[model samples]
Target chain A: MLEVRNLSVSYRHTWAVERVSFVLQPGQVAGLLGSNGAGKSSLIKAILGLIPCASGAIYWKNKPVTKQLNKVAYVSQRSQIDWDYPVTVEKVAMMGRISSTGWFRSHSKHSHLLVRQALERVGMWQYRASQIRELSGGQQQRVFLARAIAQDAELFLFDEPFNNVDSQTESIIFDIFAELKAQQKALLVISHDLSETLENYDKLLLLNKKLIAAGSIETVLTNENINKAYNRYLPVGNSDQRGFPSLPLLTNQKTPELQKSTRC
Target chain B: MLTWLTEPLEFEFMRQAIAIGLSLGILSAVVGSYLILQQMGMMSGVISHAVLPGISIAFFLEINVAIGAFIAGILSALLVVNIQKRSRIKVDAAMALTLTSFLALGVILITSLNTDRINLDEILFGDILGVTSSDVWRTVIITAIILILTKLFYKELEFYTFDPLGAKACGLPVNLLYFGLICAITLTIVASMQTVGVLLVMSLLVGPAIAAYLLVKELDRMMLVGSIIGAVSSIAGMYGSYYFDLPSGAAIVMIIFGFFLLAFLFSPTQGILTAPELKNKVFYWLRSLLN
Candidate 1:
């Protein structure tokens, strides 16, 4: 179990995220949603200790979260990587074990097998020797997914993973998330894809600097809450429809399935 | 023909210079590959110039110049990082400020000291023929230390260089890794001081590494190929300097540039003139001529 209490972050001395609280349990997928500059990335960075939090206490397993970083696998945004770097997919995937492999030592056979399995899971084993720059955008995302999978962590935090990804990658990510949840691993995904895919998350966190609401999809996606999160009023769905996920945005697809009910 | 090669080694100074040059070549290529990957070429330049103030202070206090230079180089690197952390200025802008100010301060101190023993020209352009046996030993020790540490930390350094943010989030001490890299680069510069002075040191650091980068797909292989390129250029430059009485530092830099040009034009994977796109056009043109 992971518990965050009153987490606040400031960028250049101005508060970006303030008094945000949340909990993540094993075997669950939580989605972090917000508008541009709404402190989504900032909050994640604070939790990871990549940036300093102004005031917050993150406890995991009844202890400070910092003590248990070994059980955490963080997949940063694709934009943060250098594609032109001279590295193979196999080497990139093997990086997940660097800390555990210890200093002054190379990866053991066990670690190698784990990387192989991770690459195979993402269907990227054939490109193990290929340079990272040669892969497509979706393929690159899958490689990063392979790295995270190889970590075999209890908690995985991914930042904006599905941005501009192909449908195949989208399905792969969803399947992996489902598999991880089945394995009792906790996942926190930061995404802006507000289509039917939003239904995949077991829970949603709506944020606009501070927490707007936190609950099941049915409770958090109310028209009043969405309006408060995006700072613009949106049409409300049927009030009694509390059992299923709501498609909040209309995509380029012409399918009438969600064309009228979802708009961002 | 053999006498030309054997004659230079007869002189003790020539032997020391050659040993120092070759060792410095390998060190610079290995360390410079990291700099090029991190996009810190300008920072290397900044540290190289920023060592002057340290050298002046060392001379005034009668301490070893190399020790002074190492301290100054590292100090400049830390100052750049500190400035970047505390202000909105990026590393590039921070380096620019630190470099000019340090260099200006160095020139003033040297002038005020009125020391005729200090030759500014030799310090800037390098006097390779003046290399002593101790300089050769320092180069060898620095090379061994750098190579051993790089091998020991290859995985962590690779991960850190490829994706710093991801490495940090994975519980790796990324800040320490960054500082270690800075220290490595400063040590590499100090080792190379005898071969190329502060002004042209960047050429030694970047030229061979970038040439290898265009040809190789792996960091380890890149370092190996770059070291080979650097060693060859350094040796050839030594011969050219011996026979033609040319300035050794300028000769080495020019040869390094030549090798870079060759790689840029003919590298197997990414060469502008020898890639598949150009190969097909050239083959078509040859067949048309025959027809």
Candidate 2:
């Protein structure tokens, strides 16, 4: 449902993300793996049309991305949001409908139902009236997930939604993603939790200033590939090594346990 | 108390003074809530001072003072917003730059206008006792219009003030909402200048709202309490000025200052000096050590 061609983004004199390219089909989740300041955020920002792109083109569902903006939904990193803001959970979730609802008229009843369903999906309906500041870190992350659900778009871009959330919340959020995939939606998730990302996503885009590798988890997540892209030492059986499941490196290991059980 | 109130109502000047004061108070309190929420108290102060030049220019041109002040306030607000967006200058420094330069221009304009017959005291220190019936009606009508408009766009305004980025992501025109807020603030300041002058107008614009902020958490309740405080303080100051022969503007400002101080010391949740735990072990230890 999405394709990118020769995308390059830079800030002033520094080249952040360079010469990146990939394609994502419907019902697929593409995981992005990179270190700090490795240009992941910049690429996402460029995709969102926030930053001026130096060079690149993006296609969403057979149309140019810039022309099909309303069809794209993004859940940005939670750190950019101010927790002390006076907005409520309901209002945040309803925000996703604004682009689609147009400017003058009030949101339609259908949009309201969608928002309610989105909240239900993330188990945040009880907190609808609650001020966003009054929620725990995990609940707050769930609120953003609900917002993305409310967008009801064909593609989803989640930027580090798992940061600061607990394991149970993360697992619950991944369940929501499974439902989205069932509906034939494409997802690009930027996560630091490489183990969860590798086990869930169908494809992995290993990036560090460039497109180090882009393919199935096994082919792209090898120890050699990660070492080449990151230039960092990784001890065998290290948690860091386990972080982005390089499938080819673990050929003898069974397929992802959760995905395997669920598929069977 | 009824007889005392009826006696004051009988005098024509006293009646007009009360009417004008009440109108200006309501306008200030309503607009001030949004300003305080957006942390734009300094911006309001800057705009209020900056309007002096526009008024002075209007005086020289022999045009209406309100129009000039409105134009000045809007123009300065635009300049400040633009500078903050385009340049690397911080908000505080940008506001200071805009306010000082415009105020300096106003000083120069006032000096230039001094060649003609002009009583600076009348404008600088308002004469509430001399407010004509036409002026009183003007204040009331303007206040009513502003209140209606505020009510109409209340939700959008609240959303914009609380979360600009979220609003933008939702495809709301964040820039337009911000500019609209500045315009509302400008109109409020212009209406208030008739009763409180530029230097003391802040007490009306920011004082009651801040006092209400200290006391309440909800936006709607804060606005209601702010308006009440504004109205009550206006009446008290007007009466005090009549009895003690004080400057009406200064008296009203002092009263609002007193309210702010009292609220600061006694508010339930956020009060500093009069908190619930002031008598607890923490305070006792600090006091004992100091002694």
- lDDT by candidate, in order shown: 0.85, 0.78
Model 1 clash pairs are none
- TM-score of chain B only, all predictions? 0.95, 0.90
> What lDDT does model 1 reach?
0.85
RMSD over all Cα atoms, model 1: 4.5
Which stretches in model 2 have alpha-carbon errors above 4 Å?
A5-10, A62-70, A99-109, A207-211, A223-264, B113-142, B214-218, B258-291
Residue-level error in angstroms, candidate 1, position B122? 1.6
Estimate, for each residue in B193-217, the C-alpha lDDT of model 1 and write its tens digit: 7777888889989999999999999
lDDT of 2 by residue, B15-131 (tens): 999998888888888899988878899888888888888888788888888889899999999889889877778999999999999988887888877723545565566667667
- List the candidates' TM-scores in order: 0.93, 0.82
Give residue A43's lDDT in candidate 1 (0 to 100). Answer: 86
DockQ: which candidate is best? Answer: 1
lDDT of 1 at A75: 84
Kindly give the stretch of ten consecutive residues in candidate 1 chain A with the minimal lDDT sum: A255-264
Note the DockQ of each predicted structure: 0.75, 0.20
